[model samples]
Target: MADEQIEVLVVGAGQAGIAMSEHLTAAGVEHLVLERDRVAERWRSWRWDSLVANGPAWHDRFPGMEFTVDPDAFASKEQVADYLAAYAQKFDAPIRTGIEVHSVRKNDGRPGFHVETSTGTIDARYLVSATGAFQKPIIPPVVPADAGLHQIHSSGYHNPQQLPDGNVLIVGAGSSGVQIADELRRSGREVYLAVGPHDRPPRSYRGRDFCWWLGVLGKWDMAAPPVGAEHVTIAVSGAHGGHTVDFRALAADGITLLGRAEGVDGDVMRFADDLRTNIAAGDANYLSMLDEADEYIARNGLDLPEEPDARILGADPACMTDPVRELDLSAAGITSIVWATGFANDYDWLQVDAFDENGKPRHQRGVSSEPGVYFLGLPWLSRRGSSFIWGVWHDAKYLADQIAIQRSYQAYDAPALAAH
Candidate 1:
């Protein structure tokens, strides 16, 4: 491969890319972010028109920009996308888009790396695969490929207008599944949400949105690692993965929650019996935590502007929804099954051999096995909140410092210390 040399190269220009760019620039580390598409292309393209961000706007915002919407309110996908575009501009991040990375190959003898892209090749001493995790859609192998069911992943969905009429079955009980189920039902489509283990909390409980406290107590950073907590955190590529999205509201809205999908044929999904138990456990966990939160507030005299009446659900459901259900994709003329099933991260372009068998890079708080190469802007990349907007800021600063220190660049070269 033809090559010139550079100090650093970053892949992907989303949140992580932006964060890394800030650090590299501050450290005076020469780096480039290789973006395959327009900045924030996934955010701008994949989201449904009716979809609003699941988290409060502030919690999802990037550095140097304030959340324009109500702190407790949700911003539509468009708004979040626009915010990202603005964030890129604010930092003047050096992101070269429309350059698809073909492969990242380690050099035969050199200590550096090689990046082959749609355009050309570039060599660098450092590579940050900020490609983010939600890389590709995953459909279960169990589902027959021949099944005449409409299947689509969340990444391909834009709005309900694109969906075929009638009932829709959204597989995977993650927040996306629940939210999409909610969206379809509102658009007058009969919806069936297949249930599974989902991590989420209510949008608001006991007069306060969980995020309000997360921001207040700085608990979002509470999960941050004790050291380099900020930079070491992972990125929340999808809101559903790291935080709780209000599933209780999904059930309360009368969305039929089916057990996990057993198999899909002719538009009918067979489900496991465990769905009942799973939902009960989820509700119980939420309620128990809410009770504790309510007590903490009362005991500490915490004041919230508005709190919903909190009630705990019994371990057993008063009535069980039937075990098996079928939504007629053909009858309803439904044309797509949105796999809110989450994304699989792909980083084949990373030339280094530092990745684990699972294809994840082994790093301790964004510090990679490869020296002179560091990563930033990952969800829980280090600490608990490492991926949240509020949580990641600290990580950004810290990781920046680590990179600076590693490079032997002292923060603001000190004037020769005054002689005693």
Candidate 2:
């Protein structure tokens, strides 16, 4: 392949990258989008066949394209992939699939960037890393390799029939864990879920979907508070037939609820005795949100239909009982262990010296410390919904504006530099 020079190079042809390319095209800037795999490959390969987006199709619209699906219907993973493919086609985005970006670094003593890819090299004046936030699956290092149990991350899970016929133990009570546990239970597999600290908002509240309230209230567009030492990872899901995934419901369905898994000692799995505390925290957050929503309704004097108290929905007598503290995986016939743990951002392939000690890039909004480098599609990049389907346009537009400004400056300064 011949070395090519472009005005801008955007990496990762996912939602964020496509958005950025669209913006750049509108700005009349020449840019190329590099993709390691096919468009929406992560959505196609990483998700289970039964997985649906956690939000309604109406709430997932991107710029220039509104969802045509039923407003309240959650789109399956396949539908989402198809939607993205159609989006790319509608925009005529200059996306090169199957070209892997191996490194992005400043061209030494040059005024541009050297972007190394599997195909060849490309020199560009600006670079944007549009890789989605969750690039790496985070499995616990404490998992013993020789534990004699079939282990898989949620990304690797497809269906229960693929697993050996036996009970299953799922660690991490986040959205993935809850949804997967529900699916496994429906498949007649005895399942045990490890509870974690999470936010449990009702799927529907006050005659509207919870996400509808969030959107109407401008919570997604609102700026987040200053970063603290620890960021809270809220776990909520819309996979339960458009209802919240409730732990009490799982317990009522004969699926055992365990405290947070502490560690594994041979076949014995120990749990933190904090199941009740975690439940209380989630309930408190849910009630707090409800209170805020009620205040908004009253302040506006809007006559929305009154709904029943949400506290009654997840009420189950068995949930309040002390959860099991330990379990023998071998003795319980638990042949498979599903780790629904969260993901990590991978920047090891990047050869730039722009990241901090924690491996996160030092950036304000999407602008990186490096002069011509930027980032997109990261969680909390600008707001709480920055990583969502509806939030990326703002960041992409901002970056495109900046790129346009730089291009104009370079054009103006070219003659001056040549004179020197």
Candidate 3:
């Protein structure tokens, strides 16, 4: 590997990296972006072909780059990927694709870091890990081993037709699981979804999108729940055009709600008897979100129509009252399982001690304890929207500001070094 040195190095060419590159370019930071794959590779290959972005295209646009298409419309994965590629090109981001980073460590007693990549090694005074939050797919350790059933994570899911025909068990009630289950059910497959605590928001509330209300309520800017706090997973989808994925709606569509998957014994899967509690928790969070929005409207005194009773909007139907406690995979005719649990951060190559007990990179507002090392595109890094496509720019801009300040200091100290 050829050795070189640079002022700054940004990893990953996704939205976070590109956004950071934009600010760095404007500041003349002299940084290079190293990407393991082509720009937006995750959007292109990691996601399902039929999947669409969760939020509206208008809200998904980055700084100075607007979606020229219908703003209100949901963009498919392909569209989103193409948009990122164009954004990188438009900004002329100094990116080198197909460069897999192996490790990053502090250069002993030096003022920079040693970044080892597939192509070469580079030393950078400032290092930004914009590898994003969803770096690794998490599968439960309790998942049946050698169960003879086809198992795939939601990230690997593409279309309903791809799976073998039979009953499908979706092990998660988050947005991805709910959307995939709905699609499978609509395609004439018997779907059994394992319920989990989540937040259920209507696709459109009153006369505006739920996301717009979230922004208005300042929820996007709000910090994440305290560590280990009981946080509700936000569940919504924009597939086949945006719509709220309600538990009652799924039940009404003949999708069976199974409780949390506890374990697997032989061919039977054990589950908890907590579907009711899960549904109730989700409903409560949904109402709470709406209440927060209403409070915001009242406090702001914006002229708008009176909102309908939230009760009527969030009421649960009798059909969803029952929950399945167990599933005999063979008896139930289940042939496949899709785990939509979530993703974990993959920092195996980061040879730094700046990690929390949970193996997450340790950082405060994108700034790590390691001098000149920073992180971007992490969930709730600075605010609630910090991980989303529309939200990462905020953290990126913040890091850019910090980097610029450091650059100025380095420049100021350069003359002293020469004199010495």
Residue 8, model 1: Cα distance from true site in angstroms? 1.6
Tens-place lDDT per residue, model 1, 136-215, is 78877655666765668877877688876666778776656766776787777767677775434555565656666555
- Model 2 Cα shift for residue 56 (angstroms): 0.8
Global lDDT of each candidate:
0.66, 0.83, 0.84
For model 2, name the residue pairs that clash: none
Q: Which is the leading candidate under TM-score?
A: 2
TM-score of 1: 0.83
True-vs-predicted CA distance for residue 66, candidate 1, Å: 0.7
Candidate 1 or 3, higher TM-score?
3
Backbone atom clashes (below 3 Å) for every candidate: 31, 0, 0
Error of 3 at 161 (Å): 2.0
lDDT digits (tens) for residues 26-116 of candidate 2: 8888999999899989999998879988888878768588666787888888888888889988979999999998877788887878878
Give candidate 2's TM-score: 0.94
Worst 10 residues of 1 by lDDT: 229-238
Reference-based lDDT, residue 340, model 2: 87
